[model samples]
Target: MTAAKRQFHADVFITLKRLVNDPEGIEIRNGLHNLGYDDVSEVRAGKYMQLQVEAANEDEALASVNEMCERLLCNTVIEEFRVSILEPQAT
Candidate 1:
């Protein structure tokens, strides 16, 4: 066998559709109202995750993330996702 190589890092954000019901977001909006800030209209909730993956290059890393979004982390029917890749900063 051969050794593995590492390439890119990614950050993913998964959020519910604007029309979807989010209990957590509702609770937060209610709390904000109770706290005397009542100008908010609607609130949508979301989640964020960071991943460090090993791939040949940026394209491969993106492909991995795309598969992950479709198969596991995101519900494409009811939710949307945003993926951001972080290049190596420096030495």
Candidate 2:
């Protein structure tokens, strides 16, 4: 008999590498400065994604999500990604 798959929630964060230029981030920072929030010196824009997956365990879920990130969610050349697996939600 096969063990039932469990639902997993993944939070994926995608960001450009530090060496890459972030025009959107710079624009945001400039806007903030114009608004008198000069304390905001730097702003690095990024993407946040939530994914729901089915897997046997946390490890499997993490592996799948990592693969997803490496394959499609992020650009390895100029971007990096981080994955966080939250506790499985109740059915």
Candidate 3:
């Protein structure tokens, strides 16, 4: 991205392959139980990524990030994501 004017931030999530057993989740729940937090039953882990973008406006920034996600970052099949918009940073 060019260091000119607009900026965009993305908070992304990539879920684990469902076929793999969720041992981490089990461990978290077990640990919580040992800590007396018995109400907590399940905890699953996922991936998170943050990105900053440079563009003319929110529309361009979004399109750029969306393209990035589709082409590079996200799997688009197994992984699902949520995106966030941040104020543009001027250079």
How close is every model to the real structure, measured as TM-score? Answer: 0.82, 0.96, 0.68
From the highest TM-score down, the ranking of the candidates is: 2, 1, 3
lDDT of 1 by residue, 1-91 (tens): 7545565789999999878889999999999899988899877789999998877667778889978998999999989998887774434
CA-lDDT, candidates in order: 0.85, 0.96, 0.73
Q: Taking the tens digit of each residue's C-alpha lDDT, what string does model 2 give over 7-89?
A: 99999999999999999999999999999999998999999999999999999999999999999999999999999999898
Better of 1 and 2 by TM-score: 2
- Candidate 3's C-alpha runs over 4 A off are 1-4, 16-21, 89-91
**Model 2: runs farther than 4 Å from truth?**
none
Q: In terms of lDDT, which candidate is stronger, 1 or 2?
A: 2
Per-candidate clashes come to 0, 0, 0
The top-ranked prediction according to TM-score is 2
Winner on TM-score (1 vs 3): 1
Backbone clashes in model 3, listed as residue pairs: none
- Lowest-scoring 10 consecutive residues by lDDT in candidate 1? 1-10
lDDT of 3 by residue, 34-67 (tens): 9999998677777788887777788777777777
